[model samples]
Target: MNSEHTKTALVLGALSGLRTLSATAVLSHYLRYNSNLKIKNRRLKFLNSAGFALLSKLLATGEIAIDKSPNIPDRVRPGGLSGRTLSGALVGAAIYSINKRRIWKGALIGATSALAATFLSFYTRKQITRNTRIPDQVIGTVEDVIAVGGSVAVLEGDR
Candidate 1:
């Protein structure tokens, strides 16, 4: 718990798992400040290089829009879950890549947290929609707001 690597991994990983967009939000801060973190993935590096933080914001906006569409599948579904996990890990790694620490710690925690959150959030949504008679779309919109707030909160913690 005292380890910065573990602390960052658990906190960022869980938040990212809960909402993949949180990754983009947190990383955007790093990019803006020209932080010491280094992104190893080619695609991620390119995205970061190409748009600074705009790419992440665009992707996050798209995700929020898609979340309300019925045509979109559950995030817990195989493909969706995989995407969440990958994004979570990458962003987690990016968050901890500074100081030349063990980056894999962040990756593992992010992926694991994403997997767990995928199931938990999915089930919670279903239950809420079923029991409360609130439409999933409405609930999803609320979730979008939560994601944004949570992402900001996580990044604020770094200060």
Candidate 2:
């Protein structure tokens, strides 16, 4: 097993757990850009040809805007958390596959990271905003920046 690849895959997967929707957009972009879905990666050819990267990124950006709204529900909600975990796993697999590593193991790492990050981010955000003078909107904005920046960094690491 290549530990370096494993680590990278885990980190990328965790990004998904943190912001699954946005992470999906990033990962999809990386996959689509890295591979033309020609001879090497026939399996994911549809992702590139169908413009999944473009569409997903747009949706993810929209969600980032919606996330700051007070009307947004907790990320730990059943549907939200489940989606994050699943997205993490899928992203992990995709990343590891690119590196020619153990795909399932990477997926597990991603899922675990997502579950952990969900709790950590949710509770920490709650406490920080509650105890500090910073407005929730500001904190949320910071988080959005982190999510998008981190996602881009993780995906670029593969290249």
Candidate 3:
């Protein structure tokens, strides 16, 4: 795949590591609004649908809200990490499919980046919260902003 596509996958994947549904939500929103871009894969056609866009947005919003709660599990946990990895893989594959490139390569890069970012972000957040004396909720909100803003920036950069 080209450098542009690779960059897209990596950025979106890292965003997924921060917030599992954020990348997919942004991607679905992009696909829904950008009628000029079409998904060549039939299976991924749902990503461009209004229903999927709405559902993804709702889920992402809920995830952001719940992320602040102390009851929520750490993202480094197996289930959370796997979910992030899958989200990255899906977003990466969708991007590659849209560009008519190799989906497997995109998936691999996305998954790997997401896995690494999960650990990196988790530890960094932990350290910041411990050393800076900032509330985790606040730090989490900042992370949410990074994920959402970063996703938007990456997709917009492509256009």
Best by lDDT: 3
Candidate models: Cα lDDT each: 0.69, 0.73, 0.92
**TM-score of decoy 3:** 0.97
Task: Give Cα distance to truth, residue 67, candidate 2, Å.
Answer: 0.4
> lDDT per residue, candidate 2, 111-141, as tens digits?
8888888888888889999999998888877
> Candidate 2 — which residues are off by over 4 angstroms?
35-46
**Candidate 1 wrongly placed segments (more than 4 Å):** 1-5, 34-52
Which pairs of residues collide in candidate 3?
none
TM-score to true structure, per model: 0.82, 0.87, 0.97
Residue-level lDDT of model 1, residues 6-123, one tens digit each, is 6555666666656677666656656666554556554456435647577677878888887788888778878888888887787666655643555677678778877887788889
Per residue, candidate 3 scores C-alpha lDDT tens digits across 27-144 of 9999989975667788788999999999999999999999999999999999999999999998988888889987888888889889999999999999999999899999999999
Q: What is candidate 2's CA lDDT for residue 37?
A: 19
Q: Could you say which candidate leads in TM-score?
A: 3
Better of 1 and 2 by TM-score: 2
Write the candidate numbers in order of decreasing TM-score.
Answer: 3, 2, 1
